[model samples]
Target chain A: MTGTASRPTLEAVAARAGVSRATASRVVNGGDGVREPLVERVRRAVEELGYVPNQAARSLVTRRHDAVAVVIAEPETRVFADPFFALQLRGISKELTAHDSQLVLLLTEGRDDHVRVGRYLAGGHVDGALVFSLHLDDPLPGLIHGAGVPTVFGGRPGWGDGPRDAVPTVYVDCDNRGGARDAVRHLVGLGRTRIAHITGPLDQTSAADRLDGFRDVMVDVDPALIAEGDFTPAGGERAMRELLERRPDVDAVFAANDLSAAGALRVLRERGRRVPDDVAVIGFDDMLPVAEQTDPPLTTVRQDIEEIGRLMARLLLRRLDRAADEGPVGAPSSVVLPTTLVRRASA
Target chain B: MTGTASRPTLEAVAARAGVSRATASRVVNGGDGVREPLVERVRRAVEELGYVPNQAARSLVTRRHDAVAVVIAEPETRVFADPFFALQLRGISKELTAHDSQLVLLLTEGRDDHVRVGRYLAGGHVDGALVFSLHLDDPLPGLIHGAGVPTVFGGRPGWGDGPRDAVPTVYVDCDNRGGARDAVRHLVGLGRTRIAHITGPLDQTSAADRLDGFRDVMVDVDPALIAEGDFTPAGGERAMRELLERRPDVDAVFAANDLSAAGALRVLRERGRRVPDDVAVIGFDDMLPVAEQTDPPLTTVRQDIEEIGRLMARLLLRRLDRAADEGPVGAPSSVVLPTTLVRRASA
Candidate 1:
C-alpha cells in the first residue's frame, strides 16, 4: 500500500498496465465481462502502483459506491419489535458482508422522511437500495423510481392503478396468497364453516394478497367475518373482539401474522373460547418466538424471512455486477419464496 | 441550475464567488467557521453553478466523509429483536438526517468479520464511527484505533490490561450502576431481604456495572443468590432456574433487563410463585413491550436509549464539524444519561 500523500492515481495505474482508462475503471468496479488475463494485469498494476480509489472519485467514474441503502419505512413503532425485520436484516447482513458491500440503514419517520430518502438516493449516495415499502399509498415507490437507483424491495410493493403509477420493480416476497390459502385450507380440513379472518394493514400488498387468498377459498363468504388488524398484538386483540362481536358462531380464525394471532389468542382465552375446540385458529408468518411462545402455541404459515433477505441482496448484487459490463442489463424479475404450514397446539 | 452532464466544479465555484478554493470547500462541507458574507457568496455561487461536490473528492480535501459507520458487534440474534437497537437507530437516523450525513451500518459476524470491518474503516470509507463493542475480548477497538478513524463508542468498551490496550475513547452510556441501585432499592423498600439477582452477560460493561451496583447495595450478600444470564429470555430462564434451586426461599429478584425479567416471571408463574405477592420482581431497560406485557407489568429502571443514540451522533458530528478548522479537536468527554425507576404491578 502506498502512503496517502503520494497515493497512485487510476491514470497512472492504467498507463502502467498498458490498458485504457475505461477498462481499468471496469475492472476496479467489479471486473464483470472482462477477460481474465486483462483483469489480472489491471489488478497487478493497481497493487504495484498502490492505487487506492477515493470512494467519491471512484463514484464519479464508475458510479458505484459498493453500498446498499436498507430503507425501513414503517410508521408504527410496534412492528419494530416483531422480529420479522430482525431476521431479514441478519440474512441481509450476512450476504452483504460476504460481498464486501456496506449497509446504509435508513429508518424513515413518516411522509417527510420519504422526501429525504428520495433525495438521498437521487444524489447517488449508494449503489443500490433494499426497501421495505409496505403501504399502498406510500409515495416512496414513485420517488425511488424517479431517483433511478437499482433497487430490490423487501416485500411486494402496493401500486395503485392510476396513470402515474410507479414503474414495476424487483422484490423478494413470501407467497402470502399461497400461505394464507394453506392456513385457511387447514381450518377447512378441521370441519370449521364460519371461518373468520384477521388481516394485517390492507395498505400493504402482503395483507391484501392474504385477504385475496382468503376470498379465493371462501367464495360467497359473509363480509362480517373479516376484521382489520395493523399486525400488532393490540391490533389483533381489537380485531378478534370485533370479529367475535359480529359472528358469535365463528368456528375458525386466520390471523395474518403470529403477533396478531397472539393478540387474538389472548382475547379468545379472555372470552373462554377454547382454541382448536370452539374455534381452530391459524396464523401466517410463523415467527418462531411468537408462534412457539404463545399460550397454546400457534399453528401458522412459516416463511423463510432470512432467505428472502439473502435473495434480495443476491439479486441486487447480480444486477449491479452486470451494470459494470458494456451492455444493457435486463430488468430483474421478482422472487417469491414458498411458505410452509407449521402445525402446533393452537390448531 | 446546472445539469448533471455539466455540473460545475469547486474551482469554478470558488472563482465565481471570488474566494479561495479552500473557503469554497469549507462552505460546501457544512461551512462551520468562515464569516457570514463569504459563506453566503459561496453558497450563491454553488447554486448558480449547480455544483454537487463529489463525495469522494470532497473527502480528499476535508478528510470528512459526512458519513459515520455504526458498528454493532453482537453475535446473538435475540438482541436484534429486543427493540433496544431499533429505538437507538431511530434516534441516530433523525440526528444524522438533520445534519445531512449518512449512517453506514456494519454488523460484524465473528473474528473474520472483525478483520473486514478493520480494513474497511482503515480504507477511509467513513469520517468516524459509533461502535457498540459489548464483549470484553473484542479485538475491534485496537484494530479500529489503528485504522485512525475518530470513533465514539455506544457502550463503555471492556479492555484487558495489555501493553497494546486502546486509548480511553469517547463513549455514551446509560447509568447502569445507578439504575441497578434504584432497582435494588425498590426491592429493599418492599422489605425483601432474601433478594436474588439475575445478571446479564458479564462480558459487557453494562452487566458488570449493574452487578457491581447490586454488590454496592447488598453487602455480605450470599454468592449463591446471583446467577448469570446473557440478556436473553432463554438465558434468563436458565439463570432463574439456577437461582431458585440455590435459594428456595428467595423473596425478590432483580433482572438486568426486561426480557430477562419476562423470562424469570414465566418461571415464577410455572413454579406457582405469585408475582409481587410471593416474589416481587424488578428489571432494567424498561423496554415497553416486555415490561408492560408480562403477566403482571414489570417494575423497571428506565434509561433513554434513544437519547443515548442521539447524543452519540451529535458528539461525533460536532467533532467532524470542528475538524474542518485547522486545530486539535481536543479529546471528547463521555456522557452518562440518568435512569428512572418505573414502579409497575410486579413490584
Candidate 2:
C-alpha cells in the first residue's frame, strides 16, 4: 500500500496546534522569527501526528537535497572484497551522517554507467559528490567535471597524458611514496642485504608512487629483484615466485599492498623459508584483516584509509558551505596525509 | 558558482525546439501521447540545450523516485571490515542499476541513527529500502516497520522473545541451518568421532539456527565440545582455545564462519597441530578471501551472498511495481536460497 498518499498534511498540523497556517508554516520551515512557544506547539503536533516534511517540496525552494553522491568507478572485485574501500566508506558515512546528508552510491561497471552517472550528477539530485577515480584511464573525473557538481575526490586524479581538463580538483590521499620509503628503510635497517620489490599495476598513481619510492631506496639495485604485480594475491604469488627464481638470495620483499604481500607470505611459507630469518616481508596499506591475520603478522605501511574518506567529505562539505554562502568556490588546496610504518612479527 | 541556477529550463527547450510549451512538456515527461516527430525534435533541443529534468519538481508530481535506500543497521566494524556486507552491496547495486534506480546507503551507528533512519524512510526520499539488521535487539526492524516504508530485510528477523511486530516481513536469507547441517555431516563423514562446534552470536537467528543444525547431527555430544564464538577472528581464536583446552583430542572442528575458521587455524598452528592431520576443520560462509587465503584453505558451507542481495532488490522492485499498477499491493513471498558444501584442503 502507498503510505505516501496517507501521510499527515501541514494543514492538519496547523489545525492540531491551534495556530494560524502562516505561523505554523514559519515554525515548521525552521522556526525562523517565530515565537518559541508556537515552535514547540507545532513541533509537538508534528510528533503526535507523525508528520514528516516533504523533502521534494522543500528541495524545490532550497535547491539543496541534503544528499551527496559517492561514485566508485572500479569494476574490480576488490571494491567488494578488499577492506581498503570499505574503510573509506565507513569514514565517509560517518562524516555525512554528522552533516545530516545522505550518501547516494553510484557503482559504475564500465563506460555506459559513466554516461548515466554524468547525467544523474547533472540532474541535480544531490548537493555534491565524492568520487573515487582509481585508475589513470578512468574517465570519471572528466565526466564529473563536465557535470559541474561540487566534488571532492578520494585520490588524486591523474590522466595518462597531461591535464585532461583545466579545472582544479580537490582530493585527499595518503602519502604512498613516503610510506613505501618507510617500509624499505625499515627492511634496510634490519640489514636485509638482497631486497626485492613487488610492483602493483603501474597505471594507478598510488602503485606508481610506491614503486618510485622503492627505487628511491634501492638505487643501483639489480632490476631482477623487481617483479610486477597487479595488487592481487594471485599476482603477488606469481610475482613472488618470479622474484625468487630471478634472485634466489633475496632477503626481503616490499610488496605494493597487503593483499599481494599476503600472497608473498603464502609463497614464502610454501617454499620452506622462515620469515624474518630467510626472508623478511613488508606490505603497503596495513589493512587489519590481512595485516593482523597473516601467519607471522605483517609489518606494513600504515595509511589511514578511513581518514582519507573523512577528509574528502570534510573538504567537499566546506566547498559546498562556502559556495552556499557567497560566489564561486575557490579551488581548495589538495592534501596528502602522512603515513607511518607499523612494525609486526614479519620484520 | 551554482550550476543549479544556470541549468537549462524546460521553457528554454520549448523555445529552442520551435514547438508549443505543452508539446515540449509531453516530450520531456515520457513523451506520452506526443507525436514521434515532435518528440524527436524536443529530444534534440533538450540535448543541444543540455537540459536536465529537475528531480524535485518531477517527484512532486509523479510521487516516484527511482531510488532505493540500503540501510545497514550494524554499528560494528564488521559492516566496514567484513567482505560479507560489501558483496551484498555489489549485488544490490547491479540489480538496482539494471532497474534504473539509485542506491542510497544509510549506515547507522546506534540508537540515535535508528531514529534518524526511521524518519528518513518515512520522509519518502527513496522508493523503498533494503535493510540489514544483524542482531535481534537491533530495534531497526521495528522502527522501519513503523515508518511504513516498503521494505525487504536482508536476513530473517527473529525477536528474542515473541514476534515483535504484527506485519509479516519479507526477507531473503540463505539456509543457514541447512548449511550448518551439511558442514557437520561432512565432518562426521570424515570419521572424526570427537568433533567440536563453534557457534556465532546466539542472539541472531542465523547463529541460533546454525547451533541447532549442529545439534541435529551431533546429538548427545559432550557440552565441553561446544564453544561460543562472536563470528569474529578473535572470537574464533578464543573459542578454539577453550575447545582445545576442554577436549584436546577433538579430531575435528566446525566453525560458525570462515573468519573464526581462520582464527581457529591460527591457534591450531601455534599449538603445533597439523591441519587435516591432527584436527580436520570446517567453516561456514566460504568467504573467498578468508577461505582461500587461509593456510591449507578451508572446507566450508558456501552461501550465495550476492544472490541474496540481488533477490532482495528484485522482491522490493516487484512490490513497487505492483503498488504503482494497482490499489493495494499484495505481500511478496520471502525467499530462502540453498547452500552447498565447498570442499577445500582443511577438511
Candidate 3:
C-alpha cells in the first residue's frame, strides 16, 4: 500500500503497471476493455499508488453529471403554496438520493424564464429533465425535446395528443376520471340528484378529466347543474355562490379539489346550508391538514402524490440508463396510479 | 464584432491579442491582472472570436459550481403536506433563479443519510447550503460545520441552547410571539374572559415563543386556561376536546396555527358549540385557504410565507458570498420579519 507521503497520479499508476494512460483510465473508471491479468496488475498498481480519480475530471470523461433537473412551470408563489408540488418534490428527492443522483429544481414564471429554462436544459447542464404542472399548449415539450435530452412529465399534458415524436417521455398521473366518478357516485348513492359541479381550470388535464367524469356520472342523473371554479378557495366560493344563485335547490356539489370544496362549504354555511343536510359536498385530491380540518370533514379522492413522484423518478432513471437497448428508451409510456375515494361526513 | 461564420477559438484570440493562454483565460474569466491595453485587446479579440467559455472548463478552473443546495429535513410525505415548507422552497427557488444559479434539493431521512449529505456538501458539490425545518437538538448543524462547508438555517434551532459553533448562518423567522399576543388580545377585546390556548409543539421556537406571549398576555387576565397541541390537526382536535371537558365555561381559544385552529373548530362543531356566538376562535398563520374554510371563517395572524422564503434566500446568498470571501465562515445569524393580525368572522 502507498504511504501517506504523497498520493500518486493516474500517470504514475499507468507507468508502474506498464500500461497506457487511456488503459489505466478505463480500468480506474470501471469501463470495459483490457484482459483480466492486465486489469489485475493495473488495480494493484492503483492501490499501491493510492490514486483517487478527480470527480471533475471523471465527469468530463464520462459526460454524465448524474443530475436531473425538475422544472416547475408556474410562479414561485403558487408552486410553494400547493401541497401537491411539495409532496412530489419530496418523493423525487428521496428516490434520487437512493440512486446517488442529484436533483436540480427550476421554476419558470414567464415566457422569458421559459426561454432561459429551455436554453439551460438544452445546454447539457443536466443528464435528464422532469417537467411538472404543464399546461395544454405549452411549447416546453417541443423545446426540451429539440435539445436532444430525455424528458419525463409529471402529469399528462392537457392536449393529450400522445407523444408527438421519437422523443422519449414517461407520464405519471393519478386516476382523475375514476376518482371523480367515484365521488359523484357517492353523491348519487346519497340520493342527491341535483348535484352541482365546481370544476377546476378547463385548460388543465386533471380539471377537464374530473369535469368529464362528473358529467358522465351526472348524465345518468341530471346534467343541468354544473359550474366551474379555478381550483382556488376564492374561485370555489364564487362558483358555489353562482350555483346557489342559479339554482337555490341544488342539494350537492362536487369540487375538483379540496381547496375549492372547502370554499364551497364556507359559502354554503353563509347561506344557512347545513353540510350533508342541506347540501352534500365532495372534493378531489385529498390534501392533508385542510382536508382533515374541514368542518364535517370532507369526502374526497385521495391521490398518492409521494408514490407518483417515486414512480416518476424511477421511470426517468430507467430512461437515463438506456435500458431499452433493443429499441428507443422510455417509449412514450403512460402510468396511471389508482386513486380511491375517502369517505367523510361532508358527503 | 465576430460574425457567426468566423467564430474564433481561445488560441486564435490569444494569437491575435499577442498574449499567453493563461493571460487570455484570466482576462476572459474576469480574473484580476494584466495591463489595460492588453486587457482591451483581449476583450476585442473575444468579441471578434465569439468565443463563449465552456461552463465545465470554467467551473474546473474557478472551483465554483454556482449552485446552492436546499436541504429539507423532513420525510417526503410531510414535505408535501406542509404549505410552509412549499412556500419557503418556492421563495428560495425564485431568488436563486434571479441570481442565475441552480438550486439543488436534498432530503435526509435518517442518521446515515445525514452522513451522505455531509460528504456531498464537503466534496465541493455545491457552493453553499440552505437548511430548513430543523428539529430541536438535531446534529445536522454540527455535521455541516464539521464538513467545512457554509450553511444557512431557516430558523433558530430552538434546542434551548445556542448554536454549537460560530458558523455563519442566516435565519428568516416570523414574529410568532407578537402575533400570538395580538391574537389573544383580540379575543380579550371580544369580552371573552375564559380564554384557553392551544399551542404548537413546545420544542419549536415559534411554539415556545407564542406560548410565552400567550402567558404574558394572560397574566393580566388568568393563567389557568392553557392547553398544548403538537401543531397537527389531530393534536389540536384532542387538545380542544380536553379543554372543553376540563372547562366547559371556556369561551375563547387561540391556536398556534391555522390547521390546529381548524381542528378545534371541527371539535367544537361536533360538541354542538356555535363558533363566534358560543366560543370565539383565533388561529396563527393566516394560511389563506384554511382560514377561509373554517366555519364562521377564522381570525388569524398573517405571516407572509412567500416573503419569508424570499428573504431567507437573499440572506443565505449574502452569507454564501461572505463565507467564500473569508475562510470557514462565521456563526448563525437571525432575521425576524413582522406579522399582522387578520380579522375574519370567527372572533
Candidate 4:
C-alpha cells in the first residue's frame, strides 16, 4: 500500500489555493518574489493537503540535496565489534541533526564495497561526504579524491610514505602520538624501565602513530619488547604472551587501546603476576566501561573520540556552507585535538 | 572546483562516438533497443571521458534511489556507548551491501529529532526504511507510519495497551519469551527458588516479553523480586542493590542483558556474595566481550542480533522488489528467530 500515489501534487495545491500554477510553484520554492497573501494561501493549502515537496524534484532545480554521505571503510569486523565507531557515529549524528542535514551512511567491508561507495559518490546524490579511511594502503582516499566530492576525513589519512604524503584535505584527528607518549611516560615515571608495547594493526594510521609515540619515549628499549596487535582483546592477549616469552623481565606494558589493555591484563593475571607490584599497565583511548571495569582499573590516555567526530562534521559543514555562498572556497585547515593522561590504579 | 560543471555530457559523448545525443542517452540508460556496435562505441567514449550519469536526473525516470534509510531512535547515550548497536549495524550493513543498496542513518536524540526524522522520511529520499523504536511511548512509530514508507521494524513493536494496537507491519525479533523461560528453568534446576529478576526498561516490548517468560516459570513468585533496569551496568547495579535490600535471601539473579548482569555481578561482589556459591547470576544477550571478561563468566540466553538485522533488511528488500512488480502487495509477515541458552560459570 503506497500512500505516495495519493499524495497531493502541485496542480492540486494550486487548485485548492485558487492560485495560478506558476504562483503556487514560486511560493513552494522558498516564496521568493511572491507576495505574502499568495504565499500564505499556498502554505495553508500545503498544510491542509500535507503535500511534502519531493526532494528529488527540488534537487533538479537547486542542485543540492541538503544531505551528506558518511563513508566508513572498516573491512575488519574487529572495528565494529567494539564501541569506538559507535561513539564517533553518535557525535556525528548529533552535529548533523543540528545542521538540519540528513546522514547517508555508506559502509564498505572491503575492495568490492569500495567500488560501490565510489559509484554512489560519483552518482551526485549528496552535497558532500565525511570519510573515515584508517588504513594506510586503503584506496578510498584516491577514489574519493577522483570523485571530486568535497570530503572531510575522520582520522589523519596516511598515503604513500610519510605523514607529508597525506593530501591537503580537511580532517579531524586526536593527538594519537601525544596520547601514546603520555601513556608510556606515565609508566616510565612509575619506574617501569622494561616497558613493552602492544600495537594495533600498523596499517591503520592511529595504530602507527601510537607505535611511533611509544618508540619516542622508549628510545633505547629492547626490540624484543615490542609486539603487534590487531586492536582486539584476543590480539592483545597473543601479543602480550609473545612479549612475555621474549622478555620475561618486562615489568610494564602500554597497549594501543583499552580493549587490548584488558587482554594484556588477563594474560598477566593468568601468569600469576600482581598488577602494580609485578607489572604496571597503561592503555590508550580511556574507554570508560573497559577502563573502569577492569580487574584493577586501568590508567590510560584520554582522547575525546566523540569530539573528534563532532569536529569532523563541523569542518565539513562549514566547507559546504562556504561553497554554497560563492565559488572557490579555500581549503579548510585540519584539526588535531589535544589528549590528556587519565590516571588510575593500574599504572 | 566543481567536477560536475566540467563533467562530460551526453552531447559530448555522442560527438566522440559519432552518434546522436538520443542514441548516447539510450545507451547510457541500459542500452535497451540500441544495437550492440553503437552501444559498445558509446560505452567506450563514456568511459574515456569518465562520464557519470547523474542519479538526480535518472531517479526522475525510475522513481527509485535504490537507497534504504536506517533510523535508530535512542535518546540515551548508554545504547550507543556499547557494542550492542554496533553488532546490529554490522549485520544490517552486510545485508544491505549484498543487495547493492545504500544505508542512510537517521539517529534521533529527542522529540525535535523525531519531527526532523519524520519529515526526512516523508521527503522520499530513500526507497524504504528499517526502523528501531525500542520504547513504547516513542512517537516514532506513529510518525514513520504516517510517512507511509515501506518499513520493517527491528523488534516486536509495542503500541498503547493491547498487541492489536500495533499497526500491521513487517518486523524481526528474537524469541525473548522463550529465552527467558530457558534462563528461569535453568535457575530452578539449580534449586534456586528465590530468584530475582533485573529487567530492561519495561516500556520496550522485549523487556515486557522477558518478564512474562519469567512469570511463566515461577507461578508463585513474589512481585517484589522484580526490579526495572535500563539495560546499562549502572542500572543493573542499582536494581541489584534494591533487590538485595528487599530480599537478602535471593539466591539467584537473572539480568535482562549482559551489561546489566555485569553491573549486578559487581554489586554482588561488593556485597561479599560469591558468584554461584552465594548467588548465581544469569544474563540475556550473552554479549561475548562482557560475559567472558567478567570475574566469573555469565550464563545467559543468546540471540543472534546480527541475524535479526540481516532478516529485517531481507524482509524490507523483498517488499520493495515485489512493490516494483505491480499492485497492492500483501501484508508482509514478521519473523521471530530462535534463541539458545549459553552456559557459563555464573549459573
The DockQ ranking, best first, is: 4, 2, 1, 3
Q: For each of the candidates, what fraction of the native contacts does it recover?
A: 0.09, 0.14, 0.10, 0.23
Docking class of 3: incorrect
lDDT tens digits by residue: candidate 4, B224-257:
8999998889999999999999999999999999
Q: After superposition, how far is residue A321 of candidate 2 from its true place, in Å?
A: 2.5
* Chain B TM-score (each prediction, in order): 0.83, 0.88, 0.79, 0.87
Docking class of 1: incorrect
Deviation of model 4 at B50, angstroms: 9.0
lDDT of 2 by residue, A1-107 (tens): 24543666789889999998898888866658888888889877866665666765667787677778888877535566667778888898789889877766766
**Candidate 4 chain B minimal-lDDT segment of 10 residues:** B159-168
* Ranked by lDDT, top first: 2, 4, 1, 3
| Candidate 4 segments exceeding 4 Å error | A1-64, A160-168, A176-198, A210-226, A242-282, A289-301, A341-347, B1-54, B160-167, B178-196, B216-222, B248-254, B272-282, B289-299, B340-347
CAPRI-style docking class of model 2 based on DockQ: incorrect
**Best-matching candidate per lDDT:** 2
Per-residue error for A23 in candidate 2, Å, reads 15
Go through the candidates in order and give each one's C-alpha lDDT. Answer: 0.79, 0.81, 0.75, 0.80
Of candidates 4 and 2, the better by DockQ:
4
Per-residue error for A29 in candidate 3, Å, reads 18
What TM-score quantifies how close candidate 4 is to the native fold? 0.78
Report the error of model 4 at residue A57, Å. Answer: 4.9
Candidate 1 positional error at A180, Å: 3.2
Tens digit of per-residue lDDT, candidate 1, span B1-347: 00112345789989999999999989876668899999989967765554555654445576666667887776525437567887787677778878767666666555455645655566566778888745877666655664666777787777522222233467899999989998998899999999899999998999999999999999899999999998888888999899899999999999999989999999999999999999999999988677899999999999998889899999888766766664444545789899999998999
